[model samples]
Target: MTFFLLRFIFACLLLPCLWTTASAEAVSFPELGSAVPGHGDVTYLDLARMVIPDLAADKDGFFRGSIPIEMRHIAGPDYDGSPPATSGLSSGDVLNIKAGGKDRLAMLLDLGDSPDSAEGYAVLALYDITGKPALLDAVNVAVDRSTYFRDPGKLSIGPGDDVIITTSTHFNSSQGYVIAPLVMVRNDRFELIDMIYTFDENLCTNRRTQNVAFQAIADSQLYAAIKVTVTDATVPGDESCDGQPPPEASSRDISVTYHWDKNASRYVKDSDALDRLADDNAKRF
Candidate 1:
């Protein structure tokens, strides 16, 4: 009888230790100070925990169609100061915007890379006015740099109330390239329609000579124009003299236009419009 009693006491002592170990392993949020350009020492998982309670209510059906309780960082810089050099990065602004005539909250987050890994990602979330939030999109972008959305006003609202957000990876500062993705939210679900790349660079044989431009059309359509120049650099003779240079490069200019297609739910290339623009330029010259 004494032996069985002692065994029961030992089993009770081991149970708590095992439970503690299992809880530690189950933690999903990354530890603080692991990644750069982080969201002011807060992880997206952390934010999700803090806001999950508000996402549902006892009396209402899930969200209840009311604006989220908290919003900040909207119409302001996403993060303050440089990465690595700065210890604490400020979380960007969160704002409430109307999409499809419905109020929604938009926010940006920087999920820093793992301690031993260099990979990181950026997250954009849109919360319905009813307090329910959905992750609109997440991209594989650098966390150490200021790549999150900075201006709340820059979010372009489409005719159907689709939201267009502009983000970039600053791997090459001189190129100043950006990627704009259009997001559609419906029935508490987020969908990505398309992505547009814009940049200006002078390469050896090809160049993006002009910055991409956007215009709003009458039918709730968005228009974009991009200019590129390509050159043929070929030498007539393989043997070259010491003081002589190769043949001068021959170049040609081309312009492309894109229009949002509501039926297709994405942007499509418009060759006819591009040709017309080219003809107009030719007449002016």
Candidate 2:
């Protein structure tokens, strides 16, 4: 009887361990090729699908995927595997950027609207394409549903060329804005240097119709200076509002410049520019 009781206790402990091992073995993740065959065979979408967790096809046949815990750092601390709409991924979702004196691919996945505002967010992953394509690191970034990435060609900044990722937002049928984010490769990782609100515009309303534009010039070897111009006027012949008297016809022009601050790791606008931005934000919100 003593021998039989000992055997039963041992069996119970061993069974749980066996069950845990089997469960772990049952779960598997998609694997990438040991070597990249060719660019045509594999795409950023395929690579994204491999990295993203719990990939499945929706009823409409579009792919759906979730962020994994290991990649949570790329999305943000508060992001909890919220699946982005697969339709958001397009030919423009991936961009080529230079990293570590070699070519790298930057993949952007839209995460939809942020919890705090109507502004959307996204996760950017840098893949080292030297040997076997592998993810270097990822970062959570702010963007819009219709946001797109641009190379901006090359700029003479830092030790090598820098890349600018731009996102645009349409506030309403009549209002829109654009932001340009500068990202650089350093220490084997991609760092966000700054996000510049480069353009904004608003159509006919109680306020004057306005248009703002910015052009970045690499004035120095270390950084770039952004030149901004603003123009606004009240239309005389246009009746955009229903039965409302048009405001007095008036016009104004403003110009401001912003410089890159190395210490602050961002672009710093002059006092006049800062005030203008603050006033604009005050009016928008």
Candidate 3:
């Protein structure tokens, strides 16, 4: 009897220790303040100012409805920016404008990179410009998915009214990206919704089963949404991305959706638009 009691006590003690160890390995929300590998010029200000998009809100639904990102650093600057930088389409850089494209505000936002998968920081900005027609209302983008190897930050921001961002990695899955999504949302008033990651993937192509995934958002009440996606676009057997990505314009594509439902009092995906979302919520440099 004493032996069994002692064994029980020992097992209890070991369990807690194991729990702590496992918990430590898990990643959480917004990897803000994380370094960008190099670029000493990038002060913490750069990191703090940076906004990475969570796959949950980017890869799919973004193109389904509502606002769309026109252009940014992704175009190398000339395509956007106040001064014009590079070829006008690098990969990940962002800007925002009013609804109709009247007010133009540009932020030199940064995108983080990762060696393991598509990586970078992303920041989204939006505005109301019912005056201009050749303009836009919001700008969303990703950054730094270069030939890297570390688990660089893969998150974005929805800074409220004119902004939105990534939830936490807790919303992500073990496949290297978020599966369900614990995204932070706001309008005039910003607040992190306290819901567990409970969504599903609707898009992903040319990758492993359950390994690659995508997400989308739609508003049944307002008729709007943002989408997100993830895929091992890197060359086959070359996970480091040190090699060229298969092709953004690939004929094959995969995607999913996430959206809000007035009747359900939550997000729902009555539709899907994977390819369009990839082009919209693009990664930044």
Per-residue lDDT tens digits of candidate 2, residues 1-285? 332253234334223212122232121122232223355466455566545655545665445565532444322354333434332322224555555456666666555544554445566677776666677776655544334343232233433444444443434454445444556666557665545453333445344444444456777625667555555555654456676665677877666666777788656666575356546755764
Task: Say which prediction, candidate 1 or candidate 3, comes out ahead on lDDT.
Answer: 1
| Worst lDDT 10-window in candidate 1 | 80-89
Evaluate residue 134 in candidate 2 and report its C-alpha lDDT on the 0 to 100 scale: 74
261: Cα error in model 1, Å: 4.3
Candidates ranked, most accurate by lDDT first: 2, 1, 3
Q: Candidates' lDDT values, in order?
A: 0.37, 0.49, 0.28
* By TM-score: ranked, best first: 2, 1, 3
Better of 1 and 3 by TM-score: 1
For candidate 1, write residues 128-169 as lDDT tens digits: 434333444322333333334422313334533534343433
Candidate 3 per-residue C-alpha lDDT over 37-130 given as tens digits, one digit per residue, 9 for 90 to 100: 2333442223222222221223432211121234343213332323112111112222332211133322323222222324332334332222
Number of the top TM-score candidate = 2
Residue runs of model 1 more than 4 Å from their true location after superposition = 1-89, 114-119, 130-146, 150-162, 173-175, 201-210, 220-267, 271-285
Q: Please give the lDDT score for candidate 1.
A: 0.37
Summing lDDT over every window of 10 consecutive residues in candidate 2, give the lowest-scoring window.
Answer: 19-28
